[model samples]
Target: MLHHQAIITDIKAIIAQSQEKAIRTIDHQRTLMYWAIGERIFREEQQGKDRADYGQHLTAYIAQALEPELGSGFSKRQVELMRQFYRTFPIANTLYSQLSWSQYKLLLRLDSHDQRTFYMAETVKNNWTVRQLERQIYTNLYERLLVSNDKESVLAVAQNEQLPSDAKQIIKDPMFLEFLGFRRESAFYEKDLETAIITHLQEFLLELGNGFSFVARQKRIHIEGDDFFVDLVFYNRLLQCFVIIEIKTAKLTHQDLGQLQMYVNYYDRVEKLPHENATIGILLCADKNDAVVRYSLPAGQKQIVASQYKLYLPTEQQLLAELNKELYSFEKGE
Candidate 1:
């Protein structure tokens, strides 16, 4: 019986490892294939001798021929994508298949090469889904970094693969939680939201903005004679620490910050492993006062963050208005 159990365990382990390797190999091959396609398109364009009309005609011709054989992804739009695929990444060998064609298409749309490259690298490293990539890009993450940080440091983090010490600062929060299918301005108990997040934990993690994985929901911690249940706890693999989140339906207060501080301190001093970094706390509130947060937290406070979350996805106009507001505040030295 024991021998059979051992054999089963071994087989399962082998299967798991093989699946992982196969996925990587598939990604690598797909990446290489796109590179080759791009190369072929480039060569054809070069043969047309810098004539834009010839390039379009050739693409149309090729699309007509290939569409019947290759199906939908080979239409004129795809051929254009292939051309862009090569133009965006001149070196075929540099193309990585770990990221899908859609990801490349999004990156190609980005005006800034540095920003695109940064997102590409991070997407590969983090295995960001298409939705996550879209969110980050739409949020103007690159612009935010350029404004908030030193040029050299920000560029290095974006381009040279230098992981920022304060990665939390780069992580946005209250991150468009409308995916939960919750209505904005609806009154609900905090427990209801917590339960929903726990129920749809995977979606919640994606909405939480990067490097987050579920650890516990309403996790109980015993201290002295009393027991406190943390609303949500997650661990960030990239950052190497526990992230404790407190959900608030009301406006954030100094007391809330103080409570979160205690939780963070507890995780840091007692729960965190010796090798792990200090725990970080986030107050996910319906509204936040930047001035209050700044005054409540200590100086050089990198561990705690307060962000407002919306239950519904904002419309384009709403997003634009928010962006204008942010820009206006920044301009006014707020």
Candidate 2:
């Protein structure tokens, strides 16, 4: 009986795998079909280059003729999108086979070439679904990463040219916890936020960046009869270090930094193996003063990072303002 059950399970697994492969194959073919359509439309437009509105008229004419026979997929708006798609990705070879038409539509909305490239690489690397890719784009993950690192480093890491050497390469400051469903106006304690994180741990890990696996929560350590509990502990495989996160619902102070530093020291000395790199400590706080964070840690300190957590996603304008503020401070060599 057990052998028969195992055979049934194996057959089910094979069927599931084959179905997934068929779906991927169909999506890839659809992407290729769209690309071919876009290329043909673009070639037709170029033949009438002297006419200013030729491309627009040509697209509408084609859409009207095709929609009657091929249905609404060839509507004017979608046709225009196809034209833009070809313009955005001129080289057919550069199109990623793994991305579906829906994902490409979201990518088409981005204005910057570098931003598009970064998202494309990340979507493939992370196996991001259409909704996940949309959320990342809407959250402005590319711009958020750029706030700390340079463009080249961000692109290089996304392209897998090099492994992440520093946590800052992947971690974002002002981490968004809106998915935790906490209201911005409501008051909450650190434990409440921690519970919310634990409940929505998967989204938190996605927001936490790559290669992070949960280790423990409220991890206890005893030293000379004194006991202490770490709020959250995680392991980052890429950086090969343990990440200790301490939640602070109020503005960050030097004392908070000191406490986190102590935890980091303990991890380095006791928990970290000889082959592992130094443990990293992040103070996830509600607000922080940049100067205080700078002066709190010792000179040339790289292990401890203070990042703010937001209950809501910031608007593009707000992100721009924050980016500008960081850029101004960086320019002053601060």
Candidate 3:
């Protein structure tokens, strides 16, 4: 009976493996087909550069004609996408099916070859979905890397395995939180924001950058005679530490810092495993007193960090301005 069961398990495993292999093969073939269409369209377009309007019309004409014969994938937009796809990646060997059409569209918009390559490599290495890839690009992931890391490390992250130590190196301080759509001028409570974050946990984590995995919402701790709760607890696989996060809707104060310090101390003393490093704390507040944070924490302390969150996505101009600020500081050797 055991032998029969083993044989059945082996058969099921084989079937699963075959199915996965077949899926990969189909994906590869479909991507190659798209690349071929792109190549043909691009070559034709190049020959008629003098007739600029004709180029757009040609794609629509081809898509309209192909629809009845070829089926669903050939819309006018998709045909234009095919042309852009070839223009973006002329080398068919480099095209990866792991990246969807949406991701390709986003990548093709990047002006720099190195920037596009970096994002492609990271997106594949991290297995980021189309939405995740778009979010990273829109958030200026490439620019953020240029600001935070040396060229070598930045390239390594873009090309190779995403190591845990590199998480903070990639994270942007004062991450824009405008996606939440909270009114800065309104009297929204901290709990209100926290609830929203919990409701949209996946988006929140993506905005939080990489390496963070949600551990708990309102995690409880008991110390001596009192009970305390942390708003969020996450573990950064790369940093190898438990991250205790405190949320505040108002400006950060010394008292807030002290409370976070207490949480960090508690985790270090009681909750942290022997192999794990000391816990780190983050104060995600609506506002911050940078001076208070600087003087309140011990010098050269890497464990605790304070960053403000925004509830809306900023304009491209705002993003560029912020990028310039980081770049200027780096150039000044600050």
Candidate 4:
């Protein structure tokens, strides 16, 4: 009986694997079909550039003839999208097999070539679902990362051209915690925020950036007969260091920085292996004054970072403004 059950399990596994493979094959074929159609449409439009209305008339004619026979995939709007997809990609080799038609549709909406490239590389690297890709795009993950790192460096890291050497490369200054389901107007304690983060740990790690795995919550330490609890402990594989996070429900102060620094010191001296890099301390707070953060930490300090957490995602305008401010600061050598 046990042998029969084992055989059944093996067969189920094989069936599931084949099903997934079939789905992937279908998705890839659909992508190729769309690309081919788009390429043909673009070629036809080029041949009729002399006639301004010819391109419009051609699309309408094709859609009118195909929609009823081929379903709404060939609708006028979708046909336009296909044309745009060809024009945007230009090279057939650039389209990745891992990305589905839905993912491509979302990618088409991005206007910047760099942004599209970054998202493409990230989506493939992380094996992000269409929904995950959409969330990252809407949350302005690219813009947020740009706030700390230069464009070339950011793109290089995303494309796997280089591993991140600095914590700032992977970490964002104002991290979004909208997934925690916290209300913007509501008051919450540090413990409440910490509990929420622990409950929604996976989402927190996604927002925290790449290579992070949860280690502990309220991790206790002892020094000279005194005990203290660190709010959160994480290990980043890429950076090869322990990330010690301290949550602050109020605006950041110099005292908060000091306490986090102490935890970082303890982790480095006690918990960290000699082969690992220095522990990074992140002060996740509700609000922070840049000047306070700067002066609070020693000059040329890289280990401690104070990042603000928002209950809601910022608007495009707000992210743009933040990016601009960071750029200005960088230019001024701040």
Candidate 5:
């Protein structure tokens, strides 16, 4: 009976594999066809540019001619996207096999080659779905990571060429929790904020950067007679340690830093295994007092980090200005 069941399962698996292969083949063919059409259009445009100006209505005319006989898939907008796709990915051989048409469309929406290359490398490395790619772009993942480092290091990190050796390299400041649907103007408790984060845990993890998985929430720890509850606990496989996180809905203070430091020391001494790295404690506050935290911690402290959280995405202009400022500082060795 076991042998027969195993055979049946194998047959089902084979059938599923064949179906996926067929789908992939169809998609590959579709992508090639689109690229070919775009190339043809581009060549024709170049030839006609000096003799006459047919640039504006070329795709429109092509769409009108093709759609009636072929279908709605070759509409004006799609054709234009195809043209852009060819222009952006000029060399067909450089196209990634893992990327689908939908993923390519999202990549093309980005403004710069640097952003496109970073997302392309990340999408393949992480196997990000189209939805995941879109979310990362919307949250400005590139810019967030770019803030703490120079452009070269940022791009290198995105390309997976340089793995971050420290939390400072990976932990983005002023994390955007806008997806949690909290209202900044309204009154809310720390518990309420933690509950919202746990409720939307996956989005929160993505915001936290990669390799982090939830471990516990409101984790109780008893030292002597006193009790403490950590708002969130996560483990990062890449960092090879437990990450303790505490939530504060108000501005951060020296007390919060001291408390988080104590948590880090507790975890390192009591909970951390012999082989694992020391525990990392993060204090998430509504307002980050950077200078105070710097003064509170000893020089070159790596275990505890404090970061600000926002209920809404920060303004792009503000982030860009900060990124430029940071880049300048980095260049000047500040």
Candidate 6:
């Protein structure tokens, strides 16, 4: 009876695996078809380069004719997307077979060649779902990295050409938590905010950027008979270290930095293995004075960082202000 049951389970597993592979193959073929269509349109447009506005007219005519015969995917905007897609990708041979139509559609929206390439390399490297990719874009992850590191390093790290030596290289300040379903006006305790992050742990990890895996919440530590609970703990495989995170509901202060430094010290002395890198600590709070943070940590401190968190997506102006502020401060070592 046991043998029979095992055989049945194995058969079911094989069938499921086969179906998954079949779907992937079909999606790849569909992607290729779109690429081929794009190539044809691009070649036609190139041939008619002598005529002013011919490309626009050609695309419009193609959309009108294709929509009636083939359906929704060939609409005006989408046909243009196909054209842009081909132009951006250029070589059909270089198209990533693992990507779906939806992923390609999102990639088309990025404005810069470098940005598109970085995001694509990361998307493939991280095996991100469409939702995760969308969230990364809205959070402006690429720009955040650029502010911290040189352009060459940023591109290199994105494509896995170099490893991150400091946690700040990968960490984003004022991480967006709009996915937590909390209103910006909502008043909450640190515990309440921590609870929300724990509840939406997956999204939080995604927002935390790559190579992070959750370990514990409200992790308890004892020192000279006093007990303290770290709000969250995670291990970053890429960094080869443990990350201790503390949550703060209001403005950050030197006291908070001291508390975080203690945690980092504890992890480095006790939790970190000889083979592992020094553990890092992040004090995630609702607001921060950059001057305060700058002065709080010792000169050449490597293990502790403070960053703010927001309940809603910041406006373009707000983000721009932050980028300028951070760029100046980070360069000044403040």
Top candidate when judged by TM-score against the true structure: 2
lDDT of 6 at 37: 81
Q: Order of candidates by TM-score, top first? A: 2, 4, 6, 5, 1, 3
Off by over 4 Å in 4: 1-7
Worst 10 residues of 3 by lDDT: 161-170
Q: Which 10-residue window of candidate 5 scores lowest in summed lDDT?
A: 47-56
Give per-model CA RMSD.
Answer: 3.5, 1.4, 4.3, 1.7, 3.0, 2.1
RMSD of 4: 1.7
**Clash count, one per candidate:** 0, 0, 7, 0, 0, 0
Question: Candidate 3, after superposition: displacement of residue 261 in Å?
Answer: 2.5
lDDT by residue for model 1 over 31-89, one digit each (tens)?
Answer: 66766786788787888866698889888988899999999878998888888877888
Task: Rank candidates by lDDT, best first.
Answer: 2, 4, 6, 5, 3, 1
Cα-based TM-score, every candidate: 0.81, 0.96, 0.78, 0.95, 0.87, 0.93
lDDT of 5 at 311: 88
For candidate 3, give the lDDT of residue 16.
100
Candidate 3: where are CA atoms >4 Å away?
1-28, 41-80, 179-184, 289-291
Which 10 residues in a row give candidate 1 its minimum summed lDDT? 142-151
- Please write out the lDDT profile of model 2 over residues 1-334, one tens digit for every residue: 9999999999999999999989998998888888888989988888996645998899899998999999999999999898888889988888888899999999999989999999999999989999989988877888778777889999999989979988888998869888999875998889999999999999999999988999999999888899999999999998999999999999999999999999999999999999999999999999999899989888878899888888898886887788678767665777
Cα-based lDDT at residue 206, candidate 1: 62
**Alpha-carbon shift of residue 259 in model 6 (angstroms):** 0.9
Comparing 1 with 3 on TM-score, the higher-scoring candidate is 1
Cα deviation of 139 in candidate 1 (Å)?
Answer: 5.2
Q: Which pairs of residues have clashing backbones in candidate 2? A: none
* Per-residue lDDT of candidate 3, residues 114-156 (tens digit): 7888789878877888788888888787777677576567767
lDDT of each: 0.78, 0.91, 0.81, 0.90, 0.84, 0.86
